[model samples]
Target chain A: MRGVVLHAAGDVRVEERDDPRIELPTDAIIWVAAACVCGSDLWPYRGINEVTDPTPMGHEYVGVVEEVGADVRTVAPGDFVVGSFMASDGTCEICQAGYQSRCAHVEPVGRSGTQAEHARIPWADGTLVVTPGMPDADLIPSLLAASDVLGTGWFAAVAAQAGPGKTVAVVGDGAVGLLGILAARELGAERIIAMSRHEPRQALAREFGATDVVVERGDEGVERIKELTGGYGAHGVIEAVGTQEAMQQAIRSTRPGGHVGFVGVSHDVSLTGQELFYATVSLLGGPAPVRHYLPDLIDRIWSRKINPGKVFDLTLPLSDAAEGYAAMDERRAIKTLLTV
Target chain B: MRGVVLHAAGDVRVEERDDPRIELPTDAIIWVAAACVCGSDLWPYRGINEVTDPTPMGHEYVGVVEEVGADVRTVAPGDFVVGSFMASDGTCEICQAGYQSRCAHVEPVGRSGTQAEHARIPWADGTLVVTPGMPDADLIPSLLAASDVLGTGWFAAVAAQAGPGKTVAVVGDGAVGLLGILAARELGAERIIAMSRHEPRQALAREFGATDVVVERGDEGVERIKELTGGYGAHGVIEAVGTQEAMQQAIRSTRPGGHVGFVGVSHDVSLTGQELFYATVSLLGGPAPVRHYLPDLIDRIWSRKINPGKVFDLTLPLSDAAEGYAAMDERRAIKTLLTV
Candidate 1:
């Protein structure tokens, strides 16, 4: 099987790897139909996060179950499924509370890397959600998005309390941020503000239901959001970029008693307690509980109610995985989908 | 009039001051019935917060209205009232959303210093909640508690979402933290854990409905909370200490999907975003929207449903204000009541 592996900084390669097999009764072996490069992958690829050894890459995928262990009851052979980046037992107290990402028996699905010909999924009964039936080829990309980005965006919107009469401001223009606009729209936010300087991404943000776009960053971006929200700041702000500047902007761009839902992977961000205390905003963030939203997301995608797949601006064959990583790392592609 | 003045750290004195009068259309003058030394006041008294001048001290007060400006409608002369430390214009959007402490025209009642014979209150219509009527002297202390500490603790409990079937943990054992335990109990929390080592404070905590008391501090305290919650941590944690250690303990003591409501005046605290992200808890903290809870708190105090005034272990005449400050500064008193 061919899989993408990160050897070092700025180095990604597709090479032959051992095939996956069901190692436990709760496991299922899936033949991946498609996989994609994620924004988080750039952390290690850019050496911002140390690469101690050659590690498998990618955690987003949509696939057909090729085989399943005896204990896997929810998904079976020949079924199309979408799974969360993090695997959970789903029935744990935390999972039941809608925090599957922090479940008692949680595991990162990326430990085995989904960017391969076949992948083994653990806790299959809890982590994988099967489509009503085999999805059409045109629907594959959207279903693939339901595996992570779309669900994560939805979680961010929900956490932000973006709803009727809310003025929601998004602090990033990545795939997740773009989809967050869609989620806020779906949740009935009155106005959506997207902060992006790039022309194409700004256009996509508007198409995804952003009523306004601010071409600024940091304090300036916060000021712009406040200006648009009648000097009170947005009622809800989505932070999809996990930098110190982005986090501060999100916190500052919310009105008192408003909510700031951050879904970005944190990186060297330190928040002064005094500032946060005075800001008086509600904050809820972390690895999103994507598994909890997967079923609904799959339904929404199947019904053609949302088109999150448009985030895939480039696609590549699995053998050309290196190029996919390079394109996304260099900002040449919003996201790159790999045909596995 | 006489007032408490801080000449410098550890140097407080009772001195003559000008009598307060209505300064604006929204202002009201109150003849202070009583004032108290707050844990926050010790910050400046102990030199942690600089006392650069002979600043008038005290913010918590229960009093009788002396005069009302033309625009003051809710309160009038001869009315007994309990006012928030922060004055708010009740009709602002922020105030309407129940965050009156951060209202558009918010003003600190402490600027004129409530620890005086007479004090001016700005935004009187919003900040002062008139009691049903003048009550017995025995209820005066409890009503004074509602002016700040009790209301602050109530806001923390509400922010932490303490309610039926929820396990609520309280950090800090000061007047506010002690009141937080009471607030959680009033909110119908199934179990209340009070974190404190002081024997006297611990007894008061138990009296205030703490189902469990952990004498441990910092990491050990977090461990005890986790053990008590079957290793999942408490559902709601109130942070009434502003230090980094207390903040960390509060966050660490909450479950993944739990809430941490902090109300202590923050000083030199910084939170690592990565740690907060991995912890996956909802956080809402600030000076607390005390004015929002004033009416309900005053009603509860008037009905004798709660005895929050018990937190005041030391009582002093207004002229001996320096002693009241010293008792709290040295931790010899949980709180000090100054009778005018």
Candidate 2:
């Protein structure tokens, strides 16, 4: 099998790898149908996150279950499914509480890269939500998105309490941020503000239902959000970029007593206890409990209610996974789909 | 009139001052029947908060209305009333949303000094919540407690979502923290952890319904809470001390998806965006919207359902108000009451 691997910082290569097999009673091996490069993937590809060895490269996927271990019950061989980036046992107290990301028995699905011909999914019964029947070709990308980014953006919108009468702001214009605009609209938010300077992303944001676009940068960007919401700041803010600046701007763009649903993979960003206390804003976000929303998102995509997979601007064969990584890393594509 | 004034950081003196008169159309002058020194008042008296030029020092009082401006309707001359530390019009959008502390027409009851024989309350029609009638002498202290400390603590508990099947931790040993124990109990929290080392405060906490007493200090304090909570941390944390360590401890003691209700007046405390982001704790607090809780708290206090005034450990005449401040500053008193 061939998969994308990061040998060192900024070095992504397609190399031959042994095919994955179900190693545990709860594991299921799937043949990757489609995979994509995420904004988070740029963390190591840009050398910001240290990569000491050739590490597996993807977590998002829509795949066909080729084999299942003895313990797998909900899914069977040849089943079409979409799984979250984080695998959970589905029976833990945390998973019961709907925070599957913090499930007691949880592991990242990175050992057998989703950017490969074959991938191994652990805790299959809990992690993979089978699609109804076989999905149409046009719905494949959208279902692939429900695997991570779209579900994450939907969770961010829910955590931010976006609803009727709420004015929401999306801090990042990447695929997740654009999808957040769609999620906010679906959640009934009256106004959605997408912060973007890139024309293409900005255009996509409007198409996804952004009521307004603020091209300003930094603190000025916060000011634009404030102006759009009548000088009080938005009722909800979706923070998709995990940098300190983006986090601060998101916090600043929310009104007192408002909610900030942040899903950005935090790096060096931190909050000052005093400012957070004085601001009187409620902070509720982290690695989103993606599984909590997957079923609904998959249903929406399958029903053709939302086309989240439209975020993919370039598509390539699995053999060209390395090119997909470079295109997203260089900002030449919002996201790239790799067909297995 | 006579009032308590902080001449400097460590000097509080009782001196003659101008009698408060109706200064605004929304103002109402009151002849104080009783007033008390708050733990928060000790902040400036101990030099932690700058006290410049004999600042009038108190915000909690229960008194008989002596005069009312033309526009004052809800409160009239001769009515006995209890009001929040900060006066709010109570009709603005923020107030309607139950955040009176952030009301548009807000006036801190800091100028006339509640520790004085006479005080002027602004926005009288909205700020003062009248009791059913003048109460007996024994109920004065409890009613006064409802004016600030008890109400603030109740707000903290409410903000922390300390109700039904929840585990709550309170991080201050002051009067407010003690009442938070009471409030959490009243709010139906299944387990209440009081983080205090003081014997008297711990006893009071248990009496007020604390299910656990954690004597551990610093990091060990957080460890104890997590251990008691099955390693997930408290479902709710009430922050009654506005210091960096206290704030951080409160955040650390709460689990991901938990709520931290902070009522302590923040000083030099700061929070890191990264720690908060990764923790995924929602922080909701400020100068507690005490006005929002006054009606319910006053009823609870008046019915003898709860004795919140036990927080007052020392009593003195209005003339010895200076000694009350000194006693609290020296840690000789948890709270002091000044009689008229």
Candidate 3:
């Protein structure tokens, strides 16, 4: 099987690797139909995260099961499925509480490299959510989005309590942030503000139901949100950027007692307890429990009620995965989907 | 008028100050019936927070309105009232959203000290919640507690989402932590775990309805909570101490999808962003919007439903406000009430 691997910092290579097989009783081997490079993957690719050895890359994917473990009950061979980025037993107390990312028996999907032609997934019976059938070729990207980013944005919107009669502000221009704007609108937010200085992203935000676009930078950006919110700040803020500035902006742009759903993978940032305490904003985020929303998101996508797959503007063959990573890393593409 | 003043760190004095008069059309001069030293006050008194000028000492109080400016409508002369430490216009969106502490026109109760014979409360009509009548003499301390501590504790419990079927763990053994135990019980928490090493505080915690006690120190304390909760952690955690260790303990003691309500005035603590990202806990805190809960807390106190005033172990005449501050600073008293 061919898969992408990080030999070291800034060194992502697609090379032939040994095929993966069911190693655990609850595992299933899936023929990767689609996979993509995630924003978090850029952490090591950009040398911000230290990589000591060659490591498997990619976690997001939608595929057909090639084989299932003996104990697998829900999914069988040839079934189309979408699994969360993080694998969970789905029976643990944490998973039962709808936080599968924090499941005690959790495993990262990248352990078997979803970027490969075929991948082995743990906790097959619990982790994989099967679609009604093999989705039409045109619906592939949308169903694939449900595997991670769409579900993540939806979770963020829910965590931030974005809903009817509430004003929501999104603080990132990434695919997830764009989808967050869509999620907020779908969740019935009265007003949606997308803070993006970039033109392309801003246009997509508008297309995704952002009622207003603010191009201001930093504290001035927060001031703009306050002005838009009648000086009380947005009722909900979605922080999809992990920088300290983005976190502070999210906190400062939200009204006291409002919620901030920050799905960013916080990189090299720390919060001073005093300022956050003084802000009096509620903080809720983490690697989202994508599995929690997978079923509903798949249904929504399959029925053509929402099109989150628009996030992937560029698609490449699995062999060209490196180009996909470059385009996204350089901000030339919102996201890139690789066809297997 | 006489008031307590912090001349500098470790120096408290009772000195005659100019009498407070109505400063705004919305102001009301209250003849304080009872006032107390708060745990937050100890921060500057102990030099953890730098004290420069002679800062007037108290914020919590229950009193009778002696005079009111022309625009003060809800509160009038001769009315007994319980007001929050923060004076808010109460008409702002934030206030309407139940976060009065962050009201657009918020005024902190300061300088015209509640420890004095008279204190000028700004935005009187909105800040003060008048009781049905003059409170019973025995309820003065409880009424004063509701003005800040009890209300704050209740807000913490409410923010943590404590209710039936949830396990609540309280960190910090101060008066607020003890009151948080009471608040959790009132909120119908099925199991209350009080983390306290002090015998006196533990006793008070048990009296306040803590179903279990964990005396284990620091990290071990979190372990104990997890062990007790079947390794999933408590459903809610109240962080009453603002230190980094206590904050981390509260986060670690809560389940992955649980909430942490922290009311501790943060000192020099900082949270590494990556760590909190992994914890996946929802955090809500700050100077609690006490005014939002003041009305209900006062009613409960007036009806003798809760005895939060027991937190005040020492009482002194208003003229001896210096001793009240000194007792609290010296840790000789849990809280000190100054009677005018």
Candidate 4:
């Protein structure tokens, strides 16, 4: 089997590796159908996050179950499924409370690596949501998205309380933010504002139902959102970029009593308590409880209600994952899909 | 008329002043029956908040309406009223959404010197909530508490989502935090934890329905709370102390998906976005739209359902307003009520 590994910063290699096998009774083995490079993966690829030794890559995947351990019950061999980046036992109090990412028995599958020919999915019954019947070949990318990005965007929109009568402003033109615009629209937001300077991403944002697109970044971007919402700011703001500027922009763009659902992976972002307190916006976001939204996201994709996979601007064979990484790093592609 | 004034940091003076008169068409003049020193007042008195010019102090008040402008409709002369610290027109979209503190026509009546023989209240109709009738003298303190501290604490509890089966933790030992304990209990929280090292405040907390009292502060306080909640942390946390340590403690105490309602006036407090994001606690708070809660709070106070005035440990005539400030600043009094 071949798997993606980061031997050092800027060094992504698709090398031979031992195939995954169920090591726990609660685990299931799945033959990877599709996966993609995540923004967080860029942390190490860009050398911002230290990579001391070779590390497996990819935490997003949708595949066909090849085998299941004795305890696996919800999924079976030959079943098509999408799993969350974080695996949980599903029965824990935290999982029952709908925050599977914080489950007591949580396993971050990102460390195990999903970008491989075969991967072991721990707590399969809880982490993986099986798709209805066999998905169409074209729907695989969307379903794969449901595993992480799309589901995450959906969670961010939900956390932001984007619904009827809400003017939702999205910060970030990355794949997650683009999908967030689509999710907010599907969630019944009256207006969706996507912040983007890139023409291609802005075009995609508009296609995904962004009622308004602001090309400005940072403080100016907030002003644009406020101007669009009659100087009161949007009722909901989705933050998909983790930078301090983006976080502050999201907070400032939301009206008082509004919600800011931030899914961006925070890095070097220090929020002034006084500013957040004075903003009076309810802030809720983190590693989104993606598993909780996977079933619904997969349903939407399967029903062709939303095409979140459209975020993928480039597609490559699994072996050429390096090019996919470089393309996204250089801002040449919004996201890249690696076919397994 | 007489009023409390700060000539400089720590230089409080009880000085004669001109009687307040309605100036704006939406204004009302109130003959203050009772007022109190607040935790925030200590900021300037203790030299933490700058006081370059002589500043009239106090924002919490319940008094007899002396006069109303021609346009005032909801409140009139001869009515006994309790108003929020921040006067809002209440009809604005933000007020309609229940965030009166951020109302477009907001006038912080605090600057008008509520702790005086007479004070002018702006947007009288929206800022003042009249009691059923003039209350007995004994209820003045409680009614005064409802004007700000009680209302702010109630908003904090509501923001924290304290209710049945929830473990609500309060992170202030001041009048507001103690009132928050009572508010959480009123909101049906099964367990309330008060973080206070002060024996007097802890005793008051237990009386106000705090089921647990942790004397630890900062990280140790968080550890105590986590241990109390079986390592998962409280379901709700009310931050009533606006400092970096208190804010961090509040965030750390709350479980994922939990709510932290922080009403403490943020002073030099900065929140790390990474810590906030990973903690996954929903942060909701500000000056606490006290006007929104005044009616309900006043009713509870008037009916003797809750004695929020117990927060007032010292009582003094309006002439001793300077001593009142000194007492709270010297930590000799939890709260000081000034009688006019």
Best by TM-score: 1
Model 1 TM-score relative to the real fold: 0.99
Cα interface RMSD of each candidate: 0.6, 1.9, 0.7, 0.9
For model 2, residues B88-196, the per-residue Cα lDDT tens digits are: 9988766787877767677889766889999999999878999989988888999999889999899899888999999999999899999999999999999999999
* Per-residue lDDT of A268 in model 2: 85
TM agreement with the true structure for every prediction: 0.99, 0.96, 0.98, 0.98
Query: TM-scores of the first chain across all predictions?
Result: 0.99, 0.98, 0.98, 0.98
Model 4 reproduced share of reference interface contacts: 0.76
Evaluation by DockQ, superior candidate among 3 and 4: 3
For model 3, how does the per-residue alpha-carbon lDDT over A1-340 read when each residue is reduced to its tens digit?
A: 8999988876778999999999988999999999998898989888888898898899999999999888889999989999999999999989998999889899999877899899999999779999998799989999888888898899889988999999999999998999999999999999999999999899999999999999986899999999999898999999998999999999999998899999999987789999889889999999999999998888898899999999999999988878888898889999999998
Model 3, B166-206: lDDT tens digits are: 99999998889989999999999999999998888889899
Off by over 4 Å in 2: none
Best by lDDT: 1
Cα lDDT for residue B88, candidate 2: 91
| Number of clashing pairs per prediction, in order | 0, 11, 0, 0
* Candidate ordering by DockQ (highest first): 3, 1, 4, 2
Query: How well does model 1 score by local distance difference test?
Result: 0.93
| B1-340 per-residue lDDT for model 4 (tens digits) | 8899998888889898888887999999999999999999999888898899889888989888989999999888899998999999989889999999999788899888988999999999999999999899888889999888999999999999999999999999999999999999999999999999889888999999999999999889999999999888999999998998899999999988899999999988887778888888889999889988888888788789999989999999989888898898877999999998
